[model samples]
Target: MSEKMKKIIKIAIIASLVSSAYSVRAQEDELSNDSHVTTSFVKRQVAQNMSIGRAVKSIVSNYPQEASAVVSTALDMYPDKYQEIIHAAISAQPMLTEDIVKIALEKNIASCANIVKTAINAEPSYVDFVVTAAANSTPEELNEIVRVAVITEPDSADFIVQSLAQQHPNKIVDILSSAIEAVPLVGEYVVETLLAIFPNDAESVVSTAVRESASERANVKRIIETAQNFGLDEESIYKYAKEGGATDEEITAALSEATEQR
Candidate 1:
């Protein structure tokens, strides 16, 4: 071939190679975009089929805020599944238990009492978060929640009661009384913690403990002694104990013990 023809042929071959490379690059880019779209669509469909708990767990690591939004939406659509979803979500991401419970309480997605109870029951370790969340939105429900917590998770009762009593002192009597009434066995623990934490409220705490305890005689005697140790007057101790259902005889015996100790 002539030198000029050979040069033209070489140029044509180079152009063909460049065109092929560009076509391959364009095809790759298209495939990449298609893959992204397909992935997003698949996720959407999966979310719809699965429980909010499962869906949130799947996305919470990478998209916490998005997971939260998805959960909120799912709650709205399937209120019946609130408890189930809450358990699943919290189990999947224990770290988000507080956030999920707070949202549930603030939004009033389920019965405030039920939600708090369920959260505590589902994850007793998260009792503080559940109690705090309920206290924030529905303080009135705290009493019932405490009652349930004491019975359901007696081990956590001390912490729950102490936290609530410290945070809402005004509710101390109600909280202590409800807990003792629901789970009479917790009375001793409640009395011990309250006296230690709120010594100044000894009279009121002792009084409530006596009145609400199912084992009135034993609890009253214990309260009477604890009260006297706290420097409460025998007259006041007797009054509170008697009011709490200690018979006149029970009060006399308790006072006798106090006198002997003194």
Candidate 2:
């Protein structure tokens, strides 16, 4: 069997054992439901200063369906301990990062940016996954997720932006804008990254950057120049720039600069 399959089977077996133990406790104590039992169990464990990892693992494994509630409860109880809570939860249910992130966001959508950054910080390898989950949980928070994810894990900016762009095809412009806003130094790289992955959205990508950053002549010229280098034709570039809300003056100046660079 594959290593991943074997690992999954092993985890399943362990979860089954932990669940049986908890089942015995539930029956003995007349616990109402898995959700209540898990939440109460986590709160008790935290109160007693127990191993959060073990507590989280046991509850998440035994009550996968209640993982979100359990995680949310843990985070809500320990508002300042989000990193610790997210880390323990992810370590226990590495594959349930989505649920953990979603629950955290649901509990506190205002902190979408911080939640994403913390989740990614817990498991840097899951930057894309974290960003996707945060976006999925709160589509309205896509821009904030993109901004924070890019800022937190700049190394994964390309993947983060591409993932959101692909998932939110209509929000390509906003995704690009948020990403560039997070790391202005990577304005050109952000443009090229999305354009390369979403070549079909060339107009949207180029024009979005131009229109969004219209006031920043350097940013506008830089994106147009990068789009041109990415092989986007000049006429299409100008046309899309206008469509993207770039003024005739801005487009003229940007195109002139792009041409001058060539």
Candidate 3:
């Protein structure tokens, strides 16, 4: 309550702030010189102000070279803020989207879909980069990643699916199925896209669609008809339709429609 005590408390607060500023400045200087200052600086920022996104953006924008380490440290400090951390990091250093995604996914692979979503949503122009980076980092979640990527940016479905298919040729069926299942309306375009990329894998693409329809989610009728229109033989179409559990009636209707189109 005394004026002297109040003045002394005010001085103490000012001193504390000045010391903090100098400490931060020292760390900032070290960050610019050495990439290793990422952890301490990130921890201090998050501790002082729980703004993970702003903290990440500040460090990355100022020290682009240390973007990877800064992002890795931020994610480790606030795993739940993966979305904010990723968005800010990529926004600050768009060129380092790959490294940012790799770091986030490496820290929380379970958030693979969400991490990819956030990165792509933050930098829509970097959709391809975001996807490939995520795929490369967590190929095990390729299907989920593809699904979320397509859902996030359906317009880029073809390119997104094609890129992943090329990266994991063995997962062609899974990739196509996931893409179509995500945006069924794009099924026709997706099938056409993959067929264009993997011309030799037309049979696989068509069959996967047919099988996907078995779940009653994908449209087997449209897929078969599309394959038939794509110049696939009726016998192969019929075989795959049967194998995919397409009811005889559905197969008949699909094939008949294709024949009518021809």
Enumerate residue pairs that collide in model 2. Answer: none
**Strongest candidate by lDDT:** 3
For model 1, residues 3-68, the per-residue Cα lDDT tens digits are: 999999999999999999997676345334523213343256347756545655554543444445
Higher-ranked by TM-score: 1 or 2:
1
Off by over 4 Å in 3: 1-28, 43-50, 214-262
| Overall lDDT per candidate, in order of appearance | 0.72, 0.77, 0.81
TM-score of each: 0.70, 0.66, 0.72
The TM-score that candidate 3 achieves is 0.72
What total of clashing residue pairs does each candidate reach?
0, 0, 0
TM-score of 1: 0.70
lDDT of 1: 0.72
Q: Quick one: ranking by lDDT, best first?
A: 3, 2, 1
Model 1 clash pairs are: none
Residue 213 of model 3, lDDT score: 57
